[model samples]
Target: MTQQTFIITGAFLGMLAIILGAFGAHALKKLLSVEQLKSFETGVKYQMYHAIVLLLLGFNYTFSTSTMYWCFTIGILLFSFSIYGLVISDAKGKKLKVLGPITPIGGLLFVIGWANIIINAL
Candidate 1:
């Protein structure tokens, strides 16, 4: 994606992260178990973290390649979205075992993206 696109996406995701975090803290606190709430918070944290990464990458523009951009974008989608789905599903007494495997794949992509950033910096 283009730098402008990344920036826009980052801003949107950052906004969403804040919304989700607040929702979890206020609305979900009573509905979910402690463990589930923790899981939800994890999702919010990682989403915000990568949202910042996307913003930084967008602003830097020339420092990283499309591969780095895509890794973080796709990683956030897979990792954070899967966690959100899983937590909600669990709260609803449903199991989404399929999404469990995807979270690690997303994490791997994040690692790759961070590695790429480090390499580019050097």
Candidate 2:
């Protein structure tokens, strides 16, 4: 995807994260268990983190491209979205199971993205 596309996606994702965060705090609290609430927080945290990275990529358009952008985008979507979905599932009385390994992959991508940026900068 182009820089603009990913950047906009990130912005919208950021807004969603904020809305979800408020929802979790005010609304979901009474409905959700403590563990589920923590899961939601994880989602929001990752979303906000990647949102900042996306904005930075946009600003550093000249250098932020290729693998780093790809890693960041994928990591944001899978990591953040999974957390959101898991929380929602739990809230709806659905069984939330950690069947596959996702967090580690997401973290790896995040690290790679940042490393790529730093390496490119040097």
Candidate 3:
């Protein structure tokens, strides 16, 4: 993807994180248990964190690459969205067990993304 794509995706993801965070803090607070809420917050936090990284990479071409871009982009989708699915579904009384495994896979992508950054820096 081009730099603009990364920036736009990052901005969009950041916007979503804010919206989801507020939703969890208010609407979900009454619906989800403490553990569930915390899990949801973790998703929001990781989404926002990587979103900012994406934006930074977009602006600074020196450190950006297609591999890194895809790693973070796909990572955010898998990691954050999976957690959201699991938490919300569980709260509604139908836990999606399949999503439980997906969270870690997403996390693995995140680790790979970070590793890519380190390897590129070296």
Candidate 4:
């Protein structure tokens, strides 16, 4: 996707993160245990962090949008979505295994994107 489109999506993601944070602090805390609340907060934290990263990637025109944007997108989807699935997996009474593995892969993508930034700086 184009940088502009990625940025717009990042804006939406940022909004979602804020909403999720509020939800976590209020509704989720009441409904979930302390550990689950922490888990949920983790989701919001990663989502918010990568949301900013995506927004920066979108705004930085000198960077290759395709690489940075795609990495950010995939990182958000995998890292955030996995936590969502793990947290709510009881809704369907199913256990998810891939989430643990995939979350780190998403983290690795973030690392790579930052590595690229370092390379550009050099």
Candidate 5:
């Protein structure tokens, strides 16, 4: 993706993270348990973290960014979205067993992304 696309995506994801965090804090608190809320917060945290990373990647174009961008994008989708799904489903007494493994894979992608950046830097 282009730099502009990465920036826009980052901004959009950041907005989403803020909205979701607020929704969890205000609306979901009444319905979700403490553990579920924590899970949701984890999703929000990682989303925001990667969103900032993406924004940085967009702003600084010195190193390779495509791999990092894709990694962040896919990682956020898999990790955050899966957690959201898991927490939401669990709150409703449903379990998404399949998504359990996907979160770590997303995390691995994030690690790979960061590692790639460091490697490129050196």
Candidate 6:
């Protein structure tokens, strides 16, 4: 993706993180257990962190790469979104077991994304 695309995606993800964080704090608080709420918050935090990184990469083209962009983008989707799914569904009494595995795969992507930066710097 281009720098513009990264910027836009980052903005969108950041915006969504805020919205979800609010929703989790307000609406979900009553519906979820303490552990579930904590897990949801973790997703929001990771999403926001990567969203900021994406914005940085977008602004500084020298630091941006296709692999890095894809890794973060897809990682957020898989990791954060999976946690959201797991927590929400578990709250509703039917947790999706499949998403459990997907979360780590997403985390692996995040690790790879960061590793890419370190490797490129060296």
Task: Give me the candidate number with maximum TM-score.
Answer: 6
* After superposition, candidate 3 runs with Cα above 4 Å error: none
lDDT of candidates 1 onward, in order:
0.92, 0.80, 0.92, 0.78, 0.92, 0.97
Ranking by TM-score: 6, 3, 5, 1, 4, 2
lDDT head-to-head 1 vs 6, winner = 6
Residues 1-122 of candidate 6 have per-residue lDDT tens digits of 79998899999999999999999999999999999999999999999999999999899878789999999999999999999999999999999999999999999999999999898788
Cα-based lDDT at residue 20, candidate 6: 100
Residue-level lDDT for 62 in candidate 3? 77
lDDT of prediction 4: 0.78
Please list the residue runs of candidate 2 whose C-alpha ends up more than 4 Å from where it truly belongs after superposition: 98-100
TM-score for each of the candidates: 0.96, 0.84, 0.97, 0.84, 0.96, 0.98
Highest-lDDT candidate: 6
Which regions of candidate 1 deviate over 4 angstroms? none
Model 6, CA-based lDDT: 0.97
**Candidate 4 local Cα displacement, residue 9, angstroms:** 2.0
User: Candidate 5's residue-wise lDDT over 11-96, tens digit each?
Assistant: 99999999999999999999899989999999999999999999988888666478999999999999999999999888888878
Pairs with backbone N, CA or C atoms under 3 Å apart (clashes), candidate 4: none
Model 4 lDDT per residue over 32-72, tens place:
66776788789889889888888887787667556777777
In the predicted model 1, the residue pairs found to clash are none
